[model samples]
Target: MLLCGLAAVVSACGEPAPRKTGGTGTARPGDRVTAASAVPVNGGVLVDLPGNAQLLVVQPRPGEFRAFNPSCPHVGSLVNPPAGGVITCPLHGSTFDPASGAVRKGPAASGLAEVAITLSGEDLVLA
Candidate 1:
């Protein structure tokens, strides 16, 4: 009976941890960022990645998606997700274009850096 108890404990310990959902959690290349429905058309969502990186996934039009680093080019402050069709940095009042990641207003001299993502089935995957 000791062997049976030990085997049960080992199996329990070997089980994988539960995966986090929504927008916050560790993710890597080829990992699913979120469901396609989670992002709104003409707006965006912020997704957490491995190593404290952040990805901003946006949809400018139906079935059209884009991703960006979400770090403001001027000072590395995280920008808010698109609202009123604009992405804005809270620290410096910089604004960016949601569709193109272009600098719309500054303190920021450059646009946000773009990240690559692909649509896989019903999910968005880091590319």
Candidate 2:
């Protein structure tokens, strides 16, 4: 149908306007987490924030950290944190890379959404 085509075109064009920088249904910012508790050498660590924002924090390399909103681009379902660096959405089969928030597979046309993070001393603050 024409409606379906139009919807596909819109989604393929680009992402929706950036959601307010907070978590699900909230305008306030997220909380800070300790870096030592988040970044791991093997897989990722899931940190649940205020307003129901779940973040996956990964240590891709020594001294490097990355963070992403663990929500599937397809249906906004919560994505499983990476195991051996692969993030998977259980609701579907979409996969993402935690380090770069890049899409590793489809049914999800885009990557995972990045969450702002900054390091302060030994902690990572959700900005």
Name the candidate that leads on TM-score: 1
Q: Tell me the lDDT of model 1 at 124.
A: 94
lDDT of 2: 0.72
- lDDT score, residue 7, model 2? 96
Assess each prediction's global lDDT (C-alpha) against the native: 0.85, 0.72
lDDT per residue (tens digit) for residues 1-127 in model 1: 9999999999988868554222223666789888999999999988876655668899999999999888788988889999998999999899999999999999999998887789999999988
Candidate number of the best lDDT: 1
Give residue 16's error in model 2 in angstroms.
30
Error of 2 at 109 (Å): 0.3
* lDDT (tens digit, per residue) of candidate 2 on 39-61: 77656777765554556777777
TM-score of each: 0.76, 0.71
Which 10-residue window of candidate 2 scores lowest in summed lDDT?
19-28
Q: After superposition, how far is residue 102 of candidate 2 from its true place, in Å?
A: 0.7
Q: Report how far off residue 72 is in candidate 1 (Å).
A: 0.3
